[model samples]
Target: MARYDVPAENHDRVLELLRQLAEASRAEPGNLAFDIFEDIDDPTRIVLLERYVSRDAFAAHRETDHFRDLVLGQIVPLLTSRTVEQLDAEDQ
Candidate 1:
């Protein structure tokens, strides 16, 4: 699984975008899970957790038009700062 640490000020707008993004991912072949979490300490901070069946599935997801649009178009412009972490059970 991977976690995207995203920060944005446009609360309602960002949530709207997230709703769309979540809906879009649900139809993808490799998407095992897709979920979003809002940080308790900071309202602006959002975490996106993505899970896939395999590396190939992850690659396939990146090629999808919705993914492209979300990364290149919507997220980049909306986020103030973002960081992605590949989470592992051992890390905890």
Candidate 2:
């Protein structure tokens, strides 16, 4: 999971980019699920949820051009703050 706090100036762009990323991520070979959510109370806050078949699949996602070139290179710079964590599902 990941949480993004985008300043007002970058909110729209960040949200658009996240949605684009979510769409592209869903097409990845080992992706199980990809979701994006907006905070009800904070318009500038966004969250992402992702699941992969395995750690290798997740790593493959990070290595993709879309992930590396677009998300990391473009979108990341627009955020004021970001927090990401890896979680293990209770059962799969």
Candidate 3:
């Protein structure tokens, strides 16, 4: 699984774009799960949870053209900061 902690002042503006990304991601072949959450304490903060069948799936997503355009062209500009974490599931 990979997690993203994102803090932004413009969450409202990106909601539509994020929705699009979520829809696209969910339809991908190797996607196991994908979600978005907002912090109750701070609406500006969002959490992104993504799971894949394997690391190869994650890598494939990174290389996709949509992922690059969304991050580099859309979401990156709207974010104040983004922290990412990758984890290995012990049971898997």
Candidate 4:
């Protein structure tokens, strides 16, 4: 999961970039899911839920062109803050 606090002035652009990122990420062979959500109380606050086949797949995702360009190059600079967390599902 990832959370981003975007500046009010850059909200629209950030959202656009995120949409593009989601589309590209979901197309990756290693990606299982990619979802985006906005805070109702704070539109500038955004959350991303990403699921990959493995940790290696997640790492590869960060290295993808869309991730580097849209996320690192574009969206990151527009945010005031960002946080990421990694979680593993327990075996049933």
**Most TM-score-accurate candidate:** 4
Model 1's alpha-carbon lDDT is: 0.73
Q: What does the lDDT read for residue 75 in candidate 1?
A: 70
lDDT of 3 by residue, 1-92 (tens): 32334456577766666777778887889888778887788777777788888889988877877778876688878877777777665664
Question: For model 4, what is the alpha-carbon lDDT of residue 55?
Answer: 92
Evaluate model 3: give its TM-score: 0.84
Model 1 spans > 4 angstroms off = 1-8, 87-92
TM-score to native of every candidate shown: 0.79, 0.92, 0.84, 0.94
Deviating ranges (above 4 Å) for candidate 3: 1-9
RMSD for each model, in Å, please?
Answer: 2.8, 1.5, 2.4, 1.5
Q: Where's the lowest-lDDT run of ten residues in candidate 1?
A: 1-10
Give me the overall lDDT of model 4: 0.93
After superposition, which runs of candidate 4 have C-alpha atoms over 4 Å from their true positions?
90-92
Query: Across residues 1-92, which tens digit of lDDT does each residue of candidate 4 receive?
Result: 99999989999999888899999999999999999999999998999999999999999999999999999899988999999999885658
lDDT tens readout by residue for model 1, 3-91: 33455557667778777888898789888788888879877777788877777887788798987897667875777766766543242
Candidate 2, 1-92: lDDT as tens digits: 98988898988888788878888899999999999888899988988899999889998999998998768899989988889898887775
Q: Report the error of model 2 at residue 20, Å.
A: 1.4
Ranking by TM-score, best first?
A: 4, 2, 3, 1
Q: How many Å off is the CA of 48 in candidate 4?
A: 0.3
Which predicted model would earn the best lDDT? 4
User: Model 3's lDDT to the true fold?
Assistant: 0.73
